[model samples]
Target: MPLTGRNFLYLLIASGIYFLSARFAVLLFSLEPGNIALIWLPSGIGLLMVLRFGYWAVPFIVVASYLANSAGMAAVLSELAWLHTSTAALSNGLESALAATLMRRLLPEGLQSFQDIFPFVFGVCLVSTAVNSTILVVNLVMAGFFAVESSWMIWLILIVTNSLGILLLIPLAQAVLQAWESRLQMRLGDAARCIALFIICTGMTWLAFDMFAGFIFLIMPALMFLAVQGRKESVYVTLTVTVGLTVALAAENYGPFQLQTDEWSRLYLLSYLYSLIVLVLGTELYQRDLLSEVQARQSWQYRAHHDALTSLGNRSLFIPLLENEMKRAERMNRAFALALIDLDNFKSFNDSFGHALGDKVLKEFAQLVRKNLRDIDVAARMGGDEFAILFPETPMSEARHAVERLRKQVEKLTIKYHGRTIQFTISSGLAEFIPHEKHTSDAILGRVDQLLYEAKRQGRNQVQA
Candidate 1:
């Protein structure tokens, strides 16, 4: 890539971070003959850079790996350090590029489900890391760094460490990236829960490594709780801290695995940590998918039953609601009221002011209905300029009074559109259903329709019962 301003800045930052993480890993956990750490953090860093910036990041990875490896070997190998470090750098860069490409191909949707975990682990982690480790170990053997017979063991160690690096870091990195992209905000309770999980994991890590081996198992439950109840990013953060602490203490011979050889201990820990990562991430992703599905279903249902223009319950919803209220009134041996309302001269108003203003007027009237009605009352936009209201267990006198009040409110309702003032009014028909009276919902609706036309006939802007 050309050294444009943004590209140069990204390369500089990526190379610096990769170099620092490599040096840190070498200083803390370098193995014999190759300076290979049991947990090679730079591998993960390089892969993250490749995934973020594409293949443009490979040159920076190669440069950083060369510097880190040559710094460790220059004094001893002197002349040959250049050759060995060059090969190792190429391998590191190649590993990152290959892993990123494979991940994109295998998980086109990113890691958001249980099925994604398998492809990520097998395709990106094991396959790419194995190839890179083989290349590096072969170069070491050719340079006389280790015996030919020992190449297999060295390659095995490199695979385990490199795989562990990618497995541990990538999921956490993805979570951080997703959170950043979404501009996620945490509520007070959620923030508190995340902090509590972090504290619990930290304390548990100390006890497990420094005091009791059995305490390590308890950390899994803590992580599981965070995965299920806390945010995805928070869960990954707790996992990273817990794993980092466990590895650091174990390397210092402070943990239960100290009894085993260093290589075997690292391997065992890697296995446990890999399983932990999968289980926690899998649960979080599954829960997220289920939540998305539920939200989508609810949105569909709401759109299906509600009016698009006014957001009131449409005919599909109102008829069933009316029937249910009638059934309840009969069961309670009570009377209930229904009101059918029509806007006066709405067609002429629509022609005069345009459909846009007519829509605004309808929406405003729906809001008014919502504001004036009780919670138990039901309002629906039956069709254009026609609305229905259900007042359960209310007598005709009470219903008529409510309708009259609404009529007065409609007379005072004025809508201003584009500096043009528009005034409107409503005519309503009220019908009451008394218990022991044989009536179907359609019969009552027909009666209300006749009364509504009768009100319109007498004059507009009046209520007829």
Candidate 2:
């Protein structure tokens, strides 16, 4: 909220944008009775500024609202114009600040899930807009701008128009802001596809509003497709464009909502637009939540089963796989092999070169194992410096040859860490699972451990079967 150089710059930009949007809305969508725009986009702009810059934006909103309103009303009201314009500006600023404050308190996470929609619509949008509308209408009646009897209708119109402005514009602006801050990069094809979908949706929206009302329903599917397939920013932009076009066309009496009265038509149009936004955008948010949940669950499962250092299966995953493979070999009347491998003098190596190099050696060794093994083979890191492998449907001779090849590769593997050339070798024990042997995983593993110890005794960097 402090008026630093950056804050001052942002305030200037926000005020400029708010004033321009206000002028544009009044020029295009203003109704006769009170000169109120059917879609008051400056309300949204004010709210966004307040949300982003906190209470520092309130005075700028007031100044921008005063400038925009006073320009239009100065000729008619003359001296009393200052009072009316000042009241309107104060009301607009208050609405934005209050709405932003409520949103920060009630929806701290900011419209992330389906549960957020109701609170945002009712608590922030309706509540704040209603306050602004009430204050503005009361001020107008006091200033002889409208009859006391018509204050209720004018107030309702203001609420609907301002609420719709916030509802439509906030999401679009937020999406664009997020994309900008993240520097989101899209492939050329994907960007093209998104632009194409947006254009198609925009065209369809024009047809729906300008030509036939029945086409309105058809536009939703295109928007839905855009929501599902395109980026979040694109989807919000498409929705905003369609809604803007609908309002513009309706203001000119071109849409299907050209009913008995402009007020009724506006109400009908607002209803349709509100439902359209909620259904499409709500669905998109729900889908995003579901995807995030699924990804988090998958990441949790992967971390649970895999070694964080080597990305190989851990004991938890490897033991079950080994047991399953043993059962499969027995059921199919086939033979398989298991190997237990350990790095020679790993503790002393770690003491000499530190765990950083030790970790590099382990990762390199895991990669080597994966490279030498077949698709059907299973490899895992069984805690520090020890690894296990299951060679399914393989004979003892073939398994020994595979282990020997792996041992030789580990010997040749060199890790350059901190300009130090570090080389490590592995000692492994290979055991075979024959059909009808009825051997358990623990029994096989125990025999393999003994062979591993034997290999270590004979001399390191050897495979003892």
Model 1 shows how many backbone clashes?
A: 0
TM-score of each prediction: 0.91, 0.91
For model 2, give the 10-residue run with minimal summed lDDT: 27-36
Compute the lDDT of residue 159 as modeled in candidate 2: 90
TM-score for candidate 2, please give it.
Answer: 0.91
Tens digit of per-residue lDDT, candidate 1, span 1-465: 455789779878989999998887877665433445777878789888887777989989999999988876676664688989899999999999998899889986678777787898889888999999999888888777778986887788788778777876887888898889999899999999999989988898898877888888888888888887898889988887777677666666637665346556656776777777778878887887888889999999999999998889998999999999888898999899999999989898789878888888899889888888988899999998999999998999998898898889979987888988788999998899888788888999999999999999999899999
Candidate 1 is scored at a TM of: 0.91
Error (Å) of candidate 2 at residue 381 is: 1.1
Badly placed stretches (over 4 Å) of model 1 are: 1-3, 29-35, 75-79, 181-184, 258-260, 349-354
Worst 10 residues of 1 by lDDT: 27-36
lDDT of 1 at 18: 93
Error of 1 at 241 (Å): 1.0
Give the local distance difference test score of model 2: 0.86
